[model samples]
Target: MSAVTDNLGLFFGGYLRSLSICLWALVGSLVLGVLVAACRVSPVPPLRAFGAFWVTTFRNTPLSVVLFFCAFGLPELGINRSFFFFGVLGLVLYTSAFVCEAVRSGINSVSAGQAEAARSIGLNFSQGLRYVVLPQALRTVVPPLGSVIIAMFKNSAVVGAFGVGGDLWSTGQTLTSARGLETLPVFVGIAFFYLMITLPAGAILQIVERKVAIAR
Candidate 1:
């Protein structure tokens, strides 16, 4: 507590950085996830195959490996960028696979009659998905998407370990290792900051789920 109190600015700074990582990853993953999910459910065989490949490759890989590749591997190909960019990229790439699956399952939960009806109305595949199917699918997937986001937020901590400075975990390390603070208090502070994000997130998700439940 004293460690956190003494370094309030550092702790809060770390919290903001971590929050930024999660927020950016959330948007990126959601957009990418929906696209991948669309590909998974598309009538075209190649699109489905590509979607399956994407889900299989990314879902099977560890987050650490993904981040390592973005952090180190990408640089080797002469695509150097800030650690923050790479960190968010890794998070989005990894999380989007799970998000895709969640969304795909939601799409599948939709009645076959729905698509047939869309065709009955002369709507093309993409048009049906855009106007009719996807809207319903997104509503159904809200709860699972919330869980995916929470997992992504936790994973953002690992990004800090890979030299993305000013995140909570990195701040903890700096405090205990560099500033001679006790590890317990430093990490306790970090945990508190994490909960600050997660608890409200969980509550908000619960509300969203309830709002969508009957409609879904």
Candidate 2:
């Protein structure tokens, strides 16, 4: 308890930063994912190819490798920056691929007739996707999308290994080292802290999904 209480402000503050990183990363991932998913399902060959390329490249690559590249590569390109920015960037670029696939799966679930009927009504691919396909696709995908967001939130811990100071993981280490405390309590606290974030997010998604389903 002392290990956490000794620096109460530090723990809570770092937790906030971690949440902020996750929030920013989630937004970035969803935007990029939707675009990539669009390309994957697009009628144009090149568009589909580009989307496939994106999914393959990111999905296959390890997050640590991408993080190292961003953390190191940015400086080589003369964009000296903090680990927080790089961490968020790495999370977004890597997780967006999974988001793309989940969304693509949802798009796939929509009946072929939906799209065909849409086309018969003079709706083009992009317009039909926006007005018709996306609405239904989103309903099916909410749960999986929520899971992805939670996974990405947990992934923020990886950045702590790289010495990003204002995150929960690093803060845990900071408290442990500075207070000369045992590691177990610190880690357990960290785990509970993460659960606090993920559980509520999952609940919110479920509530929103249920509401949407009821409305539809």
- Measured by lDDT, the strongest candidate is 1
Model-by-model lDDT, in order? 0.93, 0.89
lDDT of 2: 0.89
TM-scores, all models, native as reference: 0.97, 0.94
Each prediction's total of clashing residue pairs, residues at least 3 apart in sequence or on different chains, is 0, 0
Q: How far in Å is the alpha carbon of 112 misplaced in model 1?
A: 0.9
lDDT of 2 by residue, 1-216 (tens): 676667678878888988888899999999999999999999999999999999999999999998998999888999888888888898899999999999999999999999998999999999999999988998888888988988998898897777677778888877778766789878877877778788898889989889977976
Residue-level lDDT tens digits of model 1 in 1-216: 889899999999999999999999999999999999999999899999999999999999999999999999999999999999999999999999999999999999999999999999999999999888888888888988999989989888999999999999899999999888899989999999999888888999999999998765
Provide the RMSD of all predictions against the true structure, rounded to 1 decimal. Answer: 1.0, 1.5
Error of 1 at 24 (Å): 0.2
